[model samples]
Target chain A: MKLGVLFSGGKDSLFACWQAIQKEEVACLITVVSQNPESYMFHTPNIRLAALQAEAAGFPLVEVETAGEKEEELLDLKRALLAARERYGIEGVVTGAILSVYQAARVQRICRELGLWCFNPLWLADQEAYMEELIGAGFTVVIAGVFSAPFDESWLGREIDRRTLDELRAIAQKYQVTLTGEGGELETFVVDAPFFAQKIAIEEASKVYRNYNGVLRIERAGLVAK
Target chain B: MILVVDLCYRDGSLSRDEFVAPVERILCRAETPFLTRHYTAVGAPDLKSADAAILCGTALMDTGYMEQPELFRWLLSFERPVLGISSGMLALAAAFGGGTEPCCEIGMVDVNVLAPDPLFAGQEVFPAYEVHEHAVRVPGEFVALAASDRCVQAIRHRSLPLYGLLFYPEVRNEWIVERFLGLAARQSP
Candidate 1:
């Protein structure tokens, strides 16, 4: 089946894409860029890099801009899916939703309306196991945003490796936060993946952190040979 | 051990992670032992060994399991506790001469308990995650236990431990699966 992935330049979305590529043809990467930094459904931090990631993975990208209103963002997502179906002839849509019924249901409704099958490969996944698999799968994921306590500016731009995962596991157990950041406690960006033909090398970035809230703003990045 | 039956389009398909793994995680957290097998590969020995069975859901667009109702005929004679979820519910119903109607519900919805059963005991109304394209037309041998405004949300056999839920309990409703497991544990020899 030809499918379009809802890419967010995040680990979950990219991991979902990798899984889809194994079983089906990933026809395109669909991204809905929200102007609202706190968009309910779409991932905000480093979302623009989805195109680069799509290019690295050799998949077509369908990008759409949204004003990020409460319910209006869903319309923009629908527009992106429609565009992907028209351009790439995708039969279904794939999502990276792990535990958010709010996000999953909205996407499911939209896909049903579009007559496209919706598949959330990460739906209700075990968070710790999922994080372990993400690292074990050779995905070089870095912290791009943090929104809760116990995460300081030092965590920004930190690659999620074994040591980081071990620390995250301890923090997750202590702070009662999800290890995979499914609760909007954190955001991640993938610099490399197993399927990537090239790796993303960050040239310049800036960090803005205050009171446990921060973002690793990638000022410049380009694809490099793996 | 609990037999988790994968009802996806094919064994080891992408949908298994979505449908089967979550249930396994729930069982794992509960410290319960479980074994998973695709519906097509389930032999008599599997049914014989399993203390209980949970038939997992599939993607809304995947109906490959429903086409082969004969594969689930064992569900009719097997008196062991069984819980079917979403597409698995359709399979359980089909094995007992139940059909389905076009009733689509995708998202969180309010489910009202219509009949008192241990699966939903003491919970009059609750929210459930539903991702089904059709609703089972409650089989004659089963009684409707709960419902949403749109369609029946749950059903169970009149005498057997067989049960079917049209919602995915693994999502924000792991308690349902836990309750089923508890019920199974009590009924086990």
Candidate 2:
């Protein structure tokens, strides 16, 4: 009667978990943390606050630390996913894989190895529709990181909105950045979502632009219980 | 035909992170104006489910689907449309007609092509950015759209909307990025 959802604190993962709570019964959320300075398999840096995300989703959090290399990271993830399935006695694995086969294939492989049902409710949906859904569902997300190109310091603290979406779309058309940032042209974090039990409240934040690398870096993300 | 090179692959794994840029380059370049997901391997994401799909390249060529062979089989079943570049191109070549052989490896280079095309637009030959080692031998039925002096650079299937290429058109300069995306931009997602 329970399932484990991969929680990323992004529009897709957060929304996936919310849908699981509504459409199926899920007990807890499992996330993987690769502490390495550069991680290929994990979401982003400073997600240590995922504990905060766990609290908001009303689920327990479990994370596995990864070090060195993507294959190694996937191996660690497979172990964590299998252990979570066993320890939680969960019947299914829920994912937010809309387009990337990299994450979906790995999750499916792990679920198969773990003998659990794999559910990707958002799989293959239209990117525009998904973005509209995130906004329509009341999720507030912001840009978190940017490579020196495509986007720079000016993009660091930008909000995800019609204008930002428009910019991303224009950039994709003009420069080839996908609307979803799936290609790593950019990445984002959701500050709040429709299912949040408590909104993530930041006392104050600064968009410190790293001029050399020149990115608006977000720091000091804190959560407040509703 | 479209070519996407995923920087997320092995050698391109700058400081142990790759796969993302190459795919991002193609998607950003393609700007298909649709929701996109990332799949671990060739068939993992089930491209057949979408109205149209683009396959990004990989780091190293692996054995079989890094996820499932069924997904590639599913893709071949699709008559709608699909674009494959680099590793994606190789994977689709195997699925639609037959196997792939080694060609120019990773990194940037100029590509030469011949013949008129649906995807390539018009021009005798153009310099598309290059990546990947695999060269595919297209089925006789699939028309060869573009080719370098060394190999078959691009191919389109006779009966289906499927296309594959050996290079990375998305890796071209910014103007080409917009121009390439313009092909699919008007179509509804």
Candidate 3:
């Protein structure tokens, strides 16, 4: 199937595209950049870097803007999907919606109305196992933001690996949080994944931690040969 | 929070959040705490502490699907306010003597409210996200609450606080979830 992935430059979405490429043809990457920092739907952290990620992966990228108001932002995504369908002849739109029905259901609804297949390759996946699979599949993902207790400022920009997974598991068990950062515990960014022809090199970044929440702002980044 | 069981197939196609995250967001908005478990972890004993239980849908089960025999037995015997979602609705139907027929819905479906029920309060037509290849034919004493052109979309037991919905309530259907939470809270000991 020819498809467009709802890319966020996050581990889950990148992995979703990687997995989809194995079975289907990924035509482009569709990204909805929410102006609302606290957008209820789309991920905001490290979002500007999505274009670079798309370039590294050698897929055309579509960027749409939304005010990110609760239900209204879905329209922006819909517009992006429609454009992808018309421009690239995509038959489906895939997302890395591991566990957010708030996100997945809306995408599915839009795809349905537009006659596009909605594929959530990471839907209902075991969180811990999914994280492991990313590392095993040679995806270098890192923490981009942390929003809750037990995930302090130190977690920002930390690479997710076997040890990190173990620590995350322990914290999750202790705090009853999701191992894969579901429930807004944290957000991730993909530095390198198997599909990337090049890796993202962060030139300058800063960790902004305040009021019990923090994010790693990527000031400058460029794609370098892997 | 309610206990949502992740019933997706384990072949790496789907994740638990396809079930857990949407419901979790709803409950979080309602200030409810939800606990998640794999379908295999849901023994009858675990059901004791939960205020309610939700069976989640799966991608792999779009065709013919069946639960573990013991799990089916336990679900049949479970006496609580339960909400069956998508594939979960099929499990409920099968457990209650109803069965699933092959269906091919995979997008937004408009289900007209046939009767007034707590889950569909004040809503005439509930638009829900559906991704199922089978629709539940509800059993005896379970009234149909809503339907799309294709099949029955919602069902409820006449007496007990048991409900099954082919439509995903976790997606833009907070009323359905809030109402179910209200029923669960009222019924919980």
Candidate 4:
């Protein structure tokens, strides 16, 4: 079956795309860019870079803009799915939802309304095992945003290597946070994946952090030959 | 050992991770032993060895398993404790002459327990995750255990340990699966 993934330039969505490609034909990557940084449904940090990731993975991208209003964002998502179905002839949609019923339910409804099948590969996944697989599968993920405490500015733009994962594991146990950041405690960006023909090179970036809330905004990035 | 049945469209399908793995994870955390096999691949040895069985759900649009009701006829005689979820529930009902109706529920729903059963002994009303396109008609040999405002949420055999839930208990309701494991342990040798 041909499917379109809801890409957010984050590890979860990209990882979901990887899984979808392995099982079905990932015809395109659909992204909904929200203006509100506090949007609950969409990932905000460096979301514009989804196009570059899509290009690296050799998939068409369907980009949609949303004002980020509560319910209006869902309408924008529906529009995006319609566009994907029209352009790519996708039969279903894939999501990276891990444990958020709020996000999963909303997306499920939209897909049902569109008469499209929805699949959440990472739904209710074991967090630690998922993180281990993400790293073991040669996915180079870096922390893009941190929303909760126990995470300082030093974690910005930090690649999730073994050492970083170890630290996160300890923090997860001590701070009551999810290891894969499913609770909005952190956000991640994949610079390179096993499926990527090229890797993302960060040319210029800036960090905006205060009181445990921070984002590594990628001001300039380009695809580089791996 | 618990037999975790995969009810996806095909063996090792993409839907396996979404439907089967979560339930396996709950069992893993509970330190329970299990074996998984696709519905088409299950054999007599699997039924003979499993102390209990949990038939996992499938994607909403994937009902290929429902087309072959004979594959599940074994459930009628297996007699061991069984828990069928969502699409698995439909299959379980079909094995006993029950049919499905057009009742679509997606996302979190409030379920009200109507009967006194160990599965929901303490809980009266609770939220559950549902992603089914149709609701099973309560089989003649079974009684409705719980329900949402729209449709029946749970059912169990009048005398057997067979049970069916129209929701995915792996999401935020892992306790239910754990409780079922506890029940299965007590009923098993």
Candidate 5:
């Protein structure tokens, strides 16, 4: 069945999309421009970049902008789904909700309201195994934000390594943080994937550290082959 | 300082997984101490010395405790403030009342707080992310602290050395966590 994968430009969403394409029918990519997503608000942050993901996965991009919070966010999503369902005739939707029911429930509700079946490709999967599957599938996912107190600015721009995965497994037991960053502990972005015809490369980047968190901004991003 | 009572078969529950890390986070947030112990290494000093206690959930039948009775008796002997999540709540109920019946598994369900309770921290209404399978009816005298749209979510022995929580408040959300920390901090000193 043709499916619309909700693309957040995050590693999980990108992986979800790839999973759908693997099943042979990813029809489109959708993203929400949140007013308070901790990134750009006016437009869907990283979606202008999604043209690359669309090219990578050979799918069309649909950008939905919600310039406010919660209810407005839901409304924006409903509009996007209805349009996608009508235009693409999508049978189902795929999402990347690792442990937060907040996002998953909203997506299910919207799909129910729109007469679309909701498909969460990554629901209830083991956290470590999930990350491994993401990396094993060959995606260059990077840390986009960090709110976990134990993490530092030095972690920004550090490619997710096996060591980092091991560290997440070990320290997560010590601190009770989810391996998937479910509590807004951190955010991520995928720069490359197996499905990508071309990969995202960052030439000019700067890391800015703050009291509780930091961001590694990619001033320049371009498409390149792995 | 805090004490954790962990007595259960492995893998039937996940509360013990979050039990230590969670209290440690709250203690770290409040600048308190986090402790650990083994069933073999501990004696009365391990529990009676703590400001509060946390009992990790278990799927091991209360019948085992009844068969042995000594360990369960020792656990109830602590008389320190207690917080029970999942099977821990069953243990608390069995400690005062009787055993639990096997019921439908519960997870990702929403819980609404019934107020004038310390765990809820005076909120009129809010959501709790639940991940449990079974719960016991509170003893006749215990007060219900929180409830879902269905069964009892929590119970507390009024005016005593115990409190029981059906939800893992530590990882539930930041708000309930802040409330749990506030009360934990007050109790610490």
Candidate 6:
């Protein structure tokens, strides 16, 4: 099956893309840039950097712009998927929905309406195995945004490794949060992955903290040889 | 009053909570009270005190039986209402002398309910999320309740309140769990 992946420059999306490549032909990576930071549907943290990530991974990427209003942004996403189908002749779209029914159901409905198959390899997948596989596959994931308690400014710009995963598990157990941060508890960025021809090198970044919530901004980054 | 058994493949370093989280959230949404236990502790689960028990899915198949022989025996001897899902369904089948056939059917597949059951109350046919290479065969003591083109999707004991499903109800929605809880609450003393 030829498929388009909903890429967000995050671990879940990229992992979904990687998983799809195993069974299907990934036609292109689709990224939706939202203007509204508080958009409920799409990921806005470090989203603009998706272009560089796509370049590093050596995949064709298509970008879509959305005003990011709740419920309204889905239309923009639909338009993006449709465009990918028309341009690349994609028969399906893959997503990295581990535990978000809100996002999965909406995407599934859109795919159904568009007559395209919906693929979610990470849906309800074992979080531990998923993370282990991601790491074992040589993907360097990092925490890019923190939205809940038990996570302070120090958590910003932290690379996800065995040690960090252990700490996150402890914090997740204590706070009763999703281990994969599926409940808006956190967001991630992929610096390097198995499929990448080049690796993302973060030369400059900033941490923006506001009222127990914070986001790590990638002010500058470039792709370097792997 | 519900018991959720985490049927995760114990690798000695991971918590099975990730597999149980969806079931937890379903109970939370339905306002149904429930308790959770790991598969290792299934040997002596407090089944008498709970209204029902649910065996969640796992990534590994051999991890289910090889890790806990006593638990498998307990489930075979269990008389209370039990629901098995995916690898859980495989465990139930193994305990009943029925074995799994190596036939992979992963992803959404159409399922047809052969008879009226509480788990699939209102639905006659629906799409289910399947992720298994081995499909369970119907034991003599149990009857097949639902089936897809490739495999038997569900099974039920002849006289006991036991059920097994090859699909994950926690995927698209928790209607299956909600219905099971309703039946359980009514069956509770």
Among the numbered candidates, top lDDT falls to 4
Where does model 3 exceed 4 Å of error? B1-189
What TM-score, to 2 decimals, does candidate 6 have? Answer: 0.62
Mind giving the per-residue lDDT tens digits that candidate 4 earns over B9-65? 899888889999999989988999999999999999999999999999988889999
Cα lDDT listed for each candidate:
0.93, 0.62, 0.80, 0.93, 0.64, 0.81
lDDT of 1 by residue, A1-226 (tens): 8999999999999999999999988999999999898788885688888889989999889999999998999999999999999999999999999888889999988998999988889887778788889888999999999999999999999999999999998999999999998888899999999999999999999999999999999989999999
Q: List runs of model 6 lying over 4 Å from the truth.
A: B1-168, B172-189
Clashes of each: 0, 28, 11, 0, 0, 0
Tens-digit lDDT track of model 5 for A1-226: 6788888777878877776676638788877666665432122234456666677666788777776574777888888877788888887787876556566656766775565656555655557777898777788878777777788887777777687888877768888888887667667768888888878887777877787577777778877777
Could you give me the TM-score of model 3 versus the true structure? 0.64
iRMSD for each candidate structure, in the order shown: 0.9, 14.3, 5.8, 0.9, 12.0, 10.2
Per-residue lDDT of candidate 2, residues A1-226 (tens digit): 4778887666677877777777667777888877664665585744666778788767888787778477788888877777777788787777777666567666656665566666665654557767887777788887766753567677876789888888887887887667787766666777787777887765545654453233333456677765
For candidate 3, give the lDDT: 0.80
Error of 3 at B82 (Å): 19
Query: Model 1 clash pairs?
Result: none
Q: Which pairs clash in model 5?
A: none
Give me the runs in candidate 5 sitting further than 4 Å from their true place.
Answer: A38-48, B1-189
| TM-scores of the models, in the order given | 0.97, 0.54, 0.64, 0.98, 0.55, 0.62
Report residue A206 deviation for candidate 6 (angstroms).
Answer: 1.0
Model 1 stretches astray by more than 4 angstroms: none
TM-score of chain A of 3: 0.97
Candidates arranged by TM-score, highest first: 4, 1, 3, 6, 5, 2
Docking level for model 1: high
* Candidate topping TM-score: 4
TM-score per model (chain B): 0.99, 0.70, 0.89, 0.99, 0.76, 0.89
Q: What is the lDDT of candidate 6?
A: 0.81
What fraction of native interface contacts is shared by candidate 1?
0.79
